[model samples]
Target: MHFLIIGGGFVGTALACELLKQAPAGSSITLANSGGPLGKGLAYGTQSPLHLLNVPAARMSWTDEQPDDFVNWLAGQGNTCDGAAFVPRQRYGDYLAVRLREHIAARPDVHWQQLQNRIDSLTPEAGRWIAQCAHGPALTADRVLLALGNFAPACPHPSLQALPADRYVGDPWQPDALSGLPADAPVALIGTGLTMLDLLISLQAMGHHGPVLAISRRGLLPKPHRENELPPPQWQAPAGWLAAGSLRSQLREVRQAIGRAQANGQDWRDVWVALRPRTTALWHRLDERARAQFLRHLLPFWDVHRHRAAPQALAVLRAAQAQGRVQAAAGRLLGARVDADGLVALQWRARGGQDTQEFKAARVFNCTGPSTRLAEGRRGLFGHLLHDGRLRPCPLGLGLEVGAGYALADAEGREQPGLFYVGPMLRSQHWEATAVPELRAHAKAAARAALGC
Candidate 1:
């Protein structure tokens, strides 16, 4: 059997390792990725020590049977990282690469190879999938996995288009995005999410003591993980909660569950931790309207609580805010234009006020998060797949729809043969799909399914 995995990031690389480990005799595994490194995707590619994994080392193991693989790896050598402590993401990237190399060496019977090219399209022929590469010849595979990760950030607001290249940085992940900024110059970040925190950390790492302003509609910062977590409560979700099909009922029940837990000397986070296993099932139960309501009304609250920051990382940010070096405001950006003083004049309206306000900064970085509309557009692989009627956008417009076993669901609601996907974009089907714990499961399942048991 032959398998092709596209998108060489964490999911892709992990899937390749899983395929190699579980492949039957005389199988071939090909990983196609034009991205920089094998396992260091955007999340782990950061060189900043301040960019730490949100989850603890113990929860980040990629292998199913070895949940302590990551923390144990950290224990090897003179390193003594605590299993419960959140560590640098760069270390996790190192872990992924090291594991991949080790797995490849251990699986000498499997014909393993990497194609350093972006797969442009997948066409099925004679029970095999032919992947067309950007700058290479087409390769046929018995199975193809789309591990396409996050795309470029969507424009935060319409006014962002007015900013000139010299004054604006669209993608914070760019190697030179933070370059050339004055140490003490005012810097405006367009979002108050985790990426904005990353920018702040990167700036601090570079000895930048600039006055940083992060603007968002609600100006919400990610909540920090508790210094000490209570044990996972044995409380069970109420009957019919997962099948309620009403967002209001589920929301109310979740809040009540957290309150009851708190009353019993447990933390609210314990409720969330306990609910992790059922999140996907609950998402499946909710209809389109309920899902939309959750996105429109509850997403922000869920994000701050569910996707929290490491305590150490948040402490630095809180200190910066207390020192007046960093500030966050609830405002809507009207647009930006180059002013007469050669600075970027960021025009915006405060959350509740009608009058427009202006703030001039030497540089601006867009950290509003990745674009979700690319799947609907006609530009790249997503578009080509949709145009070919092989892809269907989810009703919430968040990501592509996947059928059973992570198979690509066509526009006609049929599963595409020999094709599978396991990535953050699975958010459409599994609402809590982006993090390492969730994605790692999907990667292993998809790999095993592709191998036909």
Candidate 2:
């Protein structure tokens, strides 16, 4: 089998490596990615040393069997860190790139090829997939894996169109997004999530002395992980909670479970850590209505607890807040425009009030997080696929709808033969799919399925 994996981020790289590791002698693999160096993707492409990983070093191995590979590699780099330390995110990106290169070098028996080009479109012909690239010859493979990771964050407001790029930043990950930004200019950020945390830290490292205002609907921020993570506990969700069926009922049970754990002298985080293995199963148990209810009402609270920050990372923001250099407001953005004072003026309303509130800043950024909508504006490859009836989007607009064994299903609910996916977008089917532990397993499974193993 010739496997064609698009998007050489973590998943694509990992999947290709796994294929080389296990596939038959005749099997070959090809990876095509237009993004930065293969394996960096959006998450790990950061050059900032301050951007520490949220997951500890011990749990970030590329393969399950060699669990200590990453820690051992770190030691070789002259960095001494225990299992619990959150190392720089770039190191992991470097690890992935090196691992992919090393695996390819070791497996001369199987053909390994790479195309550092953007995939323009994909089509099926003669029971195989053909991928057209932006600037290369079309390639063919027996299997295709849509490892397209997270897309760029969607613009928060439609009202502010055609503004100066430097004044209004749409995507925070762009290398030049913060370039030319003034050191003491007031700034406004749209979301108070993980992205915002990274931005705050980045700004501080750049010697930005400006006051920053972050706006989110509920003003919710990710809770910081405990200084020393609690050891995993042997625990399980009660049978009653699983059978609760209703979102509200299950949420109540979860709250009660945490309360009970706290009362029993167990950290609430222990209960959360225990639930990591079961979140997907629990998500599947909910009907569409219940899932929608969870998205609308409980998602923010869930996010705060589920996606946490490194304590040291959060400390920077806290220090800024104490110095009155940072503030978070629970509000909704109504509009934005450049004012006479050469600043961006933002109008918003508090979470539960009718009165409008205005905040002005010299620079404004939309850190509203990645757009869950797989196809926005119907302009890109995903949108093109959707328009062609080759893609089925989840009803909740979270991501593409996939089928058994991670096959990509079309709008008509027909699974595309030999097409698979492994990435953050798996969140459409598995609520807890975005992190490392889940993705590594998915990559392995996708490799197996692609190879007909």
Winning model by TM-score: 2
RMSD of each: 1.8, 1.5
**How accurate locally is residue 376 in candidate 2, as Cα lDDT from 0 to 100?**
64
Global local distance difference test of model 2: 0.85
What would the per-residue lDDT of candidate 2 be over residues 1-453, giving only the tens digit for each residue? Answer: 788888888898889889889878877888888889998999899999999999888889988879888888899889878888888999999999999999998889998888888887888999998888889689888899888877778877786555667688888888987888889989999999999999999999899998899999999999998776636664556665555456677677778889998888877887788677779988888888888888998889999899999999999889999999998999988998888988888899999999998888887888888876865665656876888798888888678778878889998989899888888878888987788888999889888787777
lDDT of 1 by residue, 1-453 (tens): 999998888898889889988998799889888878888988898888779998888888877779989988888844677777888999999899899999999998989998888778888899998888889588999999999887788877666666777678888899999778889989999998888888888898888997888999888899988764424555666776546547787788888898897788767787787678888888888788888888898887888888888898888889899999998999998888788999988988989999998888999899888766545455767777888989878767678888778889999889987999899888988877789878888998898888888
- TM-score between model 1 and native: 0.95
lDDT per prediction?
A: 0.84, 0.85
How many residue pairs collide in each prediction? 0, 0
- Name model 1 segments beyond 4 Å from true: 229-245, 376-378
